[model samples]
Target chain A: MSERLLTVSSSPHARGKQTTKSIMTDVIIALLPATAVGFYVFGLKAVILVVTGIATCVLTELCCEKIMHRDVTIGDMSAALTGLLLALNVPVNCPWWVLMIGCVFAIVMVKQIFGGLGCNFANPALAARVLLVASWPSHMTGKAFIPVDAVVSATPLAIIKEGGDAIPSALQMFLGFDGVYGCIGEISAAALILGFIYLLYKKVISWRIPVTYVATVAVLSFCFGLSAYEVLIQVLAGGLMLGAIFMATDYVTSPATAKAQFIYAFGCGLMTVLIRQKGGYPEGVSFSILFMNFVTPLLDKYLRITKYGEVKK
Target chain B: MEIKKGTFKKGIHPSYNKHYTSSLPIEIMPSPKEVAIPMSMHTGAPATPVVEVGQYVHLGELIGQAAGYISANIHASVSGTVKAIEPRLMGNGSKVSCVVIENDFQDAPCENVEKYDPETVSPEDIVKIIQNAGIVGEGGATFPTSVKLSPGPDAKIDYVIINGAECEPYLTSDHALMREQAAKVAGGLHLAMKVFGLDKGYIGIEDNKPDAIEAFKALNDDSIIVYELETKYPQGSEKHLISAIAGREVPSGGLPAQAGCIVINAGTAAAIYDAVTEGKPLYERVVTVTGSGIKQPKVLLFRIGTNVNEIIEYCGGLTDDIAKVILGGPMMGPAVYDPNVPAGKGTSGILCLNRADAHIEDPSNCIRCAKCTEVCPMGLMPMYLGAFSQKRNFEKCDEYNALDCIECGCCAFTCPARRPLVAEIRVAKRGVQALRKKRG
Candidate 1:
């Protein structure tokens, strides 16, 4: 017989069915519930914002990869996931140019510049949100709109910032109805929670970060001399659910050990609670996650896991 | 001690494709026209070939003598003429001295081989019987069994453990061995108990094979206790098996006897019984040939030095779509680059895998998901270990217990990014060793 061809590879011949593309697709599927909810709450404007965010990010990623002579890995869906996340973190009526700039920065600058996906030192969406908030404060804060019909009256956190008197009822805050003013994805705690369950079921993400982060925020906010309803409001209000479930748990900027993950999530909750209670910001989710992102490398380095059957030195 | 549920923590449930060959009884393959027997089957110094070219050798005659204390003797599996003693490719992809023999088709036995009764033999004599049989661990780890049977003066060997976990996917040789030859397996365990002068022996079988478990349970009595382990990959790993059944840790750079345990394969135990009772050398073994790429999947009792090509053809030849063929269990088996390789002592399975099963994805960057850590049976942070390895950060890799990685491929298998976890960590281990050697 003529020499037959064969493939030589390392041991562990089989791989699990999940791929990077499949995992990113799972993340996209998990976000669909919140995306649908955002459309219902904010109408067609939210759809335009999402499509623009997705298109700009995907375009920016393709251009950057081509310019850098790198393999075009936009098909991995990571850029799409980043785009969806960036759109969810901004207002439904965010200006088209502002949204495009955020997408460009998140994809080309924050992610691609750092060698893409896992190499980024911070969450691309959160960093871009930070950049946008810093750049056009009035446009982001709704002060530029200044019309009762132009925007929802006040965010629950905005009401709580002025001593909690106008804070909506617990059920209303949880349902995120009656013109609840927040980012497109962050409005409905109920829909975001459904996404969280979907993520858990698909094994896309673990329960550690979301559970620990939310519990830390809820427990600490209760200790700030607020009644049970106000603490429930704090837990359900403004980006707390969305940030804890999605942003704080971004795999790229997170710790690589289970115990360190708990510590990282705890740090996020503590920072968010501290910043909300004492700092100038009314919502602390974005900055809290961003701050924790910078702390990820240190967490991974210092928190070396003691291996199984490893004896004490 | 009563086990409420026998399990070692944090392991993956890989698809145990044992069904392909588990029900089949062992059939001895017809002797090939030519057999290439490698001199080095067991670990340690490669055996020194005592027989020269053109010498007449009988079946079960010593052709290669043990070169060192840690090595085992090699015997001819077929009655044949020594056509050549030259270097040939072994299953491990190494060029070694192989005794190329032309089979005479006469199953002639050597007259000098002797058998001893277990009742009449002393503990010291029992070790000699195993050594004379040229038996080594058949669990794909070809450590000389005589060395393991005797753990030296420093170790107090209290427990005799038999490993029947066979947790690898697409291999069922050990399970079939245990099922059909339960009496031989039990008798072998008892002989090992005699060698160790031990009162208790435990056979740890993964609970997936109810028939094997039932067969072993039927032979269990006062001295022997069979425990059904939780079905998990790498559950059959020697250290993991000892830990799961004996509740002891063979520390890094340590032996099982250091933890008061002597672990043997259930197949090895049966081989020991045959050696002690009938003076049979380690010649033939059970091998499972199964995968989607094979036309037939079956277990065969094949003689050593049999060409892997003959075994494949006997299994109904390879399907046209076959891409890779592994020489052992899929999880830890070495991929053979050439079909000319012969079956050595450690080959327990021949997997003819399809393209989909054999293809490696273009690995993406590690997402730091830490699922590697979650499913690590060795409790290693493979995420960081792989990163450190790729960075050539050998020191950090060591600090993260890179050497402790059992190379089970769990991290890589579960990685959504498809990072080469085991392959990278293997680099770190080699680098660490090179560094240590340079320093020394």
Candidate 2:
């Protein structure tokens, strides 16, 4: 025993089975339902856009790390997740070149430029979606793309914004049935809910952010004089489910403590509702989440958890 | 006999690999050829050597005297001739003065050994007896039991809780003790209650050890309420256990006495019973020698001052790929570089790990998954503390209350990036303490 050289480090000689790579893999698994739904609705064009987006994001991450003389970390699957999320945020009929550009902006400008992964101040996918919406309005809007020979139509939120009553039925909006025009992943509330359930089951994400975000949106919509039916439509329409479940809950850009997370989620919901009701754009998930992402550090700093056994002042 | 299950919030459920020795009856190991008793096993000033070189010291004879108000006396574990009193390596990688003795193989008892009448023993007498017996906490903290028993008069102590919650992974010494000697453990709690002038007491045990719980329940001691706690890592932590059983939180930076509680380990309680009833000194304790790296896993009543290497050999030696040997449970145990370090009064488990089990993956960027904060029992944001500490920003660490961290390793254990969160926080804690000291 004396002759043997032992590895002596700090306490906790054991570690958990979950690693960064494993967690990313779980996230990727959770996104499969939404991706499949996107393919079903938009056909081969969606697949090509997704493949190009993933390839561009992964390659951008690898190239950035190499240029920065850092360890190549694409194996952690973070870049792949970023790419998938970015792809899902785009219109299904978006050109492969436009999707590639969005993936590069997500990985390089929003993510890697800020030291990558957890250091990113804004969620890469949301940031890229905002950039795409700003740069190529014709390609990024809900009315811009015709999905697989379907007639072009305004998204449910756009119809609501225009004070129109002839919107898609609740079931059509929930299931993203044929001719319901929207971004690839945000079209189907059912598919996003399925992915959210998988994430919850795997402990990949907690219920605090998504539950509070969507609940706030629903409650605020009712307070703003929308009828009960309209409130239900508002909750299920557009990217509310997609953004609340996947984007607003981005671990790196969200507050860590439960109390702080609630406040941040509420802020996101408030901003999202305000923008949808009064702003120029018909959608606000990307902007709302990006705004809350910038405010995350402040929330975490000010709303520190009441430490265990902390005496009341 | 219906026990209520208790738990603290925000703790993690690690894979408790206790099956290796949980069911094994404790077998007494043969005394080694020589014993090297470190003078500073307890958490205080080191004992001063009283026995000289070449002196023949009987078993349980006083070899080192408590030098301060918060130290424990040291006794010879075997009847032997003193070989040397010099600095030697300890399991935690510190060099402390040790009294080395060559065993004579003759079971000679010290002449001062005498039983006391528990029925007539005064509370002060009980404290003195515990001090003389050199009984410290056997729960790895090694705080002097006498000091804990003698909390200042101002403290409004109400409950005397016995910690039977062996929640650390790969450690079952307390479990074996509660199973085989439940009465002694109960008797020890009774004595502690008597000292505190309390009639009722509590014993908190993790629900994973149902047999141990049944052992105490079979005693039908209504005064001793045995709680079945959720089997979670660090459930046996003193503050958390106090919270779980007594429903009181020891205020931050305050002792358990502040919460009207005094928690003692089950092994410490049993030792108290033995010291009062049979006039036995705390020279031996049950140690769980088990891990994937060992050929045979067993619970053994090992003599203090025995070489850990010899104990490993007694357990059929190490497996071919044994890479690390830790002196306590894997969660908070320090891995030893020198396997020959003598087991001390606080040594509870000897966990040996194979190469695969011992390998630590290289850390990547912290994904800020908040898993650490979620699992932190202290409700601290360990990710921030770790990052601030790594960047040498001690003030931010202080502001975040890094000192409140119990160093239970929950953050590091559950970290997705394999970041050494606790290790960095430990450095920050030291830095904060030094800065405060300098300011003072």
Candidate 3:
């Protein structure tokens, strides 16, 4: 009789079949194509760097939870995703110690110290990358730009910024050919597109931010240059695809309102273009995403949706 | 004419599991040994007991009289001797004043009960008869029908919306009523429309209930059109139904009359028909006793004062895995802790769920998925409202229009984080209302 005891709560005894863990797992599945291509293109060095980043973040989060007397939430896979995204953002040739430091900074200072997961004001991965780029600029540039079985390759942004005779076809940039160099995850446009389609199909992320962000970049790029080839190069080059699809669409750090998401995306695109054209950095995806991460709360507050049946005289 | 299907935007499709009892015709249950009829069945003042203990009352005899203009009378469901008049626990988890009776097993009809010709009755007379017979909104609201009938002289009602959209999963009381008694239901619809001087009626049934829709279509009443509605949870809701069928919006914090319409539940219409024509009180209502945990899922014509335990025992008792016993449909029903609780006037279902259907998680953090906001029928952001409520910030919660929430549980059901959005928002709403009352 006790075993048949009825459980009582408020109304809505039934619930939909989704959880935060399932959502996080869906995100991991969406990132598979790009991560797989990254490991393939960058060889053992890429695998080692990614593993180091993931392991460091996981261990750092565990230690922080223990030290701060908080419940261990590594089971949610958010920390692991943070580790993986941070790993993808770094150069394939980044030293293991530098990757580990970035991961620890992300999980401990930028995330756990501010309160874990959704409580963090900015994306932990992007914050860690920005911090690394600021203090340890040497580790972020040089040597990381060399692909497997090729001589040192100048990134499209570097070649365009500095006078260089190395110009690759648009198809070469899309396919991420043998010698063209960038971050581990940002190399292949094809892989990122596959990942983007998967995310959209799974309903894990909407197309508003990624689609609008890319479209804004495409429109703003032509204002700086007139030719179609130059515009295509601008769109296809250096971290735009990866950043637009993945980082700009981070659920916690981005705006939750549909209208606010468009504003946030447009802001990200404008920041990326402005940074690339005028700022000191050759790649501007991380800085652009990080910049708009702070504006998400403001957008969510001010940009109101007209509620159903509500009217103004 | 292209039939415009009635539907509100952005509602989640929970599996409509009406198969268990949709086809099962309602079987009248034998009178239970003891009945405890709660006096406070309607929303207004509780009915005052008229019969003393030890008095023998025949079936359909009035035992409790309406205490105010906004209340309904209570009738005996069985020929019995009144054993006691005391407070008893009702299925809604509240102890209300009730008259406990000992059934004599002889189904003696009351002398005053007789059928009247609907064609000879005036609209006001029909409304008076319905009020005397204790007909309330049987759509789980139990608001006295008399109040809704008089929506004020200025409101020019255009249509009578008959709600047959039993959108809640696993309940088919109204669906069965529509299938078996369509003519009587339509008669009640006409009676309700006559009260408002309205000529047209719309019988809004979800497309999922094809048999119910077909039953209404066979009525051949040109004035009362059978409108098929899109199958969505809370489509049976008055605001959503009015919006879908009548193409008008009931303003926020307003009634259906604000949209020039009156919405009545299909069950309420059937009850009104019985009250007006057959001279019968709302003593027995068809209740769908269903879920995977029951040995037999069925729709039984339940006597109002019967206990949940008696119903469960009559339905072949509970299975070994039964976990939660709800008093109504799963979405908006109150969970019953004790089976001894009496089924109320508004009870539409008695759900005994097994562990598989009763599984729920300890709520976690919100991931800002915005699925709650997207699927919200009210268009209020439940995420911010829930967060503010959790932090006890009543001002912030009110600023986000927490008052607009219909408490439909849509946001809570759709949230990937499984946050208790509805519960927290309910708290916030109460707090804000209290604060406003204090300030005034």
Give the number of the best model, judged by lDDT.
2
DockQ, per-model, please? 0.66, 0.81, 0.70
lDDT of 3 by residue, A1-313 (tens): 3445788888788898777888788877777787888888788888998888888999999999999998888988988888888888888777888888899999988889988877788888889989887877777875566665666467788888775647677887888755667888887888888888988887888899999999888888878774778778878888899889888898889997889999999999999889888888777888899999999889999987778678557
Candidate 1 residues B248-306, lDDT tens each? 88787677888899989988999999998899989989999999878999899998999
Q: Please, what are the lDDT tens digits per residue for candidate 1 over residues A99-197?
A: 899999998878899888788889999999999999988667644222246434567787778654466677877777565768888878888899899
Q: What is the lDDT of residue A241 in candidate 1?
A: 94
Give the per-prediction TM-score of chain B.
Answer: 0.97, 0.99, 0.97
Off by over 4 Å in 2: A163-165
Most TM-score-accurate candidate:
2
Order the candidate numbers by TM-score, best to worst. Answer: 2, 1, 3
* Best first by DockQ, ranked: 2, 3, 1
Docking verdict class for candidate 2: high
For model 2, the interface Cα RMSD in angstroms equals 1.0
The TM-score, computed over Cα atoms with residue i paired to residue i, of candidate 3 is 0.97
Query: How big is the positional error of residue B256 in model 1, measured in Å on the Cα after superposition?
Result: 1.5
Native-to-model Cα distance after best TM-score fit, residue B135 in candidate 1, in Å: 0.9
